[model samples]
Target: MTDTPHTGGCRCGAVRFSAAAAPHHVSYCHCVDCRRASGAPVSAFVGFAADSVSFEGEAPRRHENGPVARSFCASCGSPIAYADSRLAADIWIMLGAMDQPAAYKPTHHAWVREQLPYVHMPDSLPRHVKSSVPRPTE
Candidate 1:
């Protein structure tokens, strides 16, 4: 990964952020909660050390959803990041919110049990029936 800092924000530019380090992992999530929150069949995210990320402008509003604290832009309601107590050391940023989203790529699919029937993915990558932190080894 490039040493260049990764930067991005919400749709309205009211919530901006920068990450000091490149993501440790990136993946597509097919969990029901993620699908509903993102209004898509799946959502992609980048994992980073919790302390590596910092917010600028208006901070994202946090919504407590079970064990995960989902953050979104209060001004435009754009999904931002998620923090789970189970994975307290890391913060997962929604890939779509990144300024250069193509810089990252999904390494696997998580929560495949909830994946929509029509959603097709390559069988070569690792897939988990439920949320997989640290990823599920083959």
Candidate 2:
């Protein structure tokens, strides 16, 4: 992990967070859950070890859907993070919430099979039909 820290917050500045270590993974997700939670065609995230992150100010409200828990800012309704118990040590933070979103480099795409027909995505990155943690039979 590099010495530099990653910092971010909600759109309304009601919630803030930081990561002290390098991200384990950075990728885009096209799952229906992610798209619905973010209100976008696709969601991009950076995964960091749970222990490496710190939250401050008003805590975001959480909504659990099965094994996944999504946290969002109550003040501005911006999605903050996604946590899946299957990846216990990892928490994926929404790239849009980052202070430096331009610095993010997505490595791959997850849940590509559910991607919307109208959403045009880059072809250079690897695309996973399902999550690596557990393949959902559709």
Candidate 3:
């Protein structure tokens, strides 16, 4: 955490959010659900504890599917965040929505078993078929 927060907003600027503390997890997801929702080959995220994050402007619309619930901006249909019941206290905000996307470098690749064949990332980061987030300690 620092005096200057990590900030970002929706495409339409209808939704804005900020994280005050350090992120718990930063990774790339290559699952089908993430690819379809983001309309991209892969999706990257930076996770912060729920208490350290605050949203302003319009509330994001949510899509719930079993244990997962994704939030997006209603105005421009931009993905905002991803939440899973398994990680109840953390919110994974899409890297694409971050004002400083370059600052958050993904440390690993998740759902590698479900990754598309043509999509390749040659980085030596750890790969997890089904990841158990190594929750960071304060």
Candidate 4:
């Protein structure tokens, strides 16, 4: 909401990052990849332009799976971020890691096909079958 840069770090404080601009999007993802990466039924992320974000403190441990690169706090094992090569212009940070988690509220659901049957979200947002990113016209 405010222009003050959004900041956050890992649970152990070994990894810190700052997002200088407002998040472009915030959403929950139910894809299997997200479930595995986050160790939760679903994952929430706040996205910012790649150029506006920077990382500091201890170097993060990274895992590469297909097009997605996930980073975790090397010291505490807290999930740091999710970056997908297909969406090179943006980087998604774990919503749980934000300093002010309530400031950025998720607006949609993604990867609904992989959503667990028991998970029920408020029926106010659009749900995407896969990614919300619009694919390029062929």
Candidate 5:
């Protein structure tokens, strides 16, 4: 685990959060589901152990996306994080919501088959047809 502090908030500044440890992994998901939900080319995220993060101010508004649940600030509509009940100990935070996004790097590109034609993926990172299995470290 890396000793890096992670902090972020909603667009309206109503909801704030901080993580004491570095993320388990970061990635850009190009799946159609992600594109529709985020209304962007790809959805970037940083994974962390659920217990390692702390929230302050107002809680996020929850939305159910199939098997996963996403949370965001109701006032500003800033995508905050995705929580999976199946993966009880982990939470996926939106990388764009981070205050210091540079501290994290995408290790992989997920749902490559759904990626837009004009969107070029870096050759350096691994690409997968679907959500990759979480490694033991993650």
Candidate 6:
């Protein structure tokens, strides 16, 4: 987090956005949904106050999967973010989209039970079979 804002956009440059404040929480999700959505072993994201983020150009293409709604770039099919409609005020931006991904630090590993055995867990993070506490902020 810095006085300077964080900014990023879709790979095709069809979509652009900015965040005025540092992200609140960052994490790597190993849930099946995230794995399928990202086409990777895990999906890394940075959570920000919804009001602090803004978008430009084309809005992300959205997909509803159970309780989660994911956004992606239509042009490049890049995973953008996941917004839980239930918590309309928060947005989880994909870490890969950040211009400064090193600034993103994952706090926890979610859905540990479903994580691939080959995927090693960092002892530093608190691993949970699922979110132990209800994420009111989503």
Candidate 6 on 7-117: residue-level lDDT in tens?
888888898889988888888888898899999998888888899999999988999976789999999998889988777788999999887788777888888898998
lDDT assessment of candidate 5 = 0.84
Q: Write out the backbone clash pairs for model 6.
A: none
**Alpha-carbon lDDT of model 6:** 0.84
Note the Cα lDDT for every prediction shown. Answer: 0.89, 0.87, 0.89, 0.90, 0.84, 0.84
Error of 3 at 15 (Å): 0.3
lDDT by residue for model 1 (7-64), tens: 8899999999999988888889999899888899999999999999999999899999
Candidate 1 vs candidate 4, TM-score winner: 4
lDDT of 5 at 138: 29
lDDT, residue 13, model 6: 89
RMSD of 3: 3.5
TM-score for predicted model 1 compared with the true structure: 0.92
Q: What are the runs in model 2 whose C-alpha is more than 4 Å off?
A: 1-4, 132-138
C-alpha displacement of 26 in model 1, angstroms? Answer: 0.2
Question: Model 3: per-residue lDDT, tens digit, 1-138?
Answer: 344358998999999999989887889999899999999999999999988999999999999997789999999999999998877899999998998888889999998998999997999999999653753333
Clashing pairs in 3: none
Clashing pairs in 4: none
Kindly list the per-residue Cα lDDT of model 4 for residues 1-138, writing each as its tens digit: 565459999999999999888999899999998898889999999999999999998988999987779999989999989988878899999999999998888999999999999999867899999887664433
* Local error of candidate 3 at residue 53 (angstroms): 0.6
Best model per lDDT: 4
Against the correct fold, how does model 6 do in TM-score? 0.90
Global CA lDDT of candidate 2, please?
Answer: 0.87
| Per-prediction backbone clash count | 0, 0, 0, 0, 0, 0
Candidate 1 error regions (>4 Å): 134-138
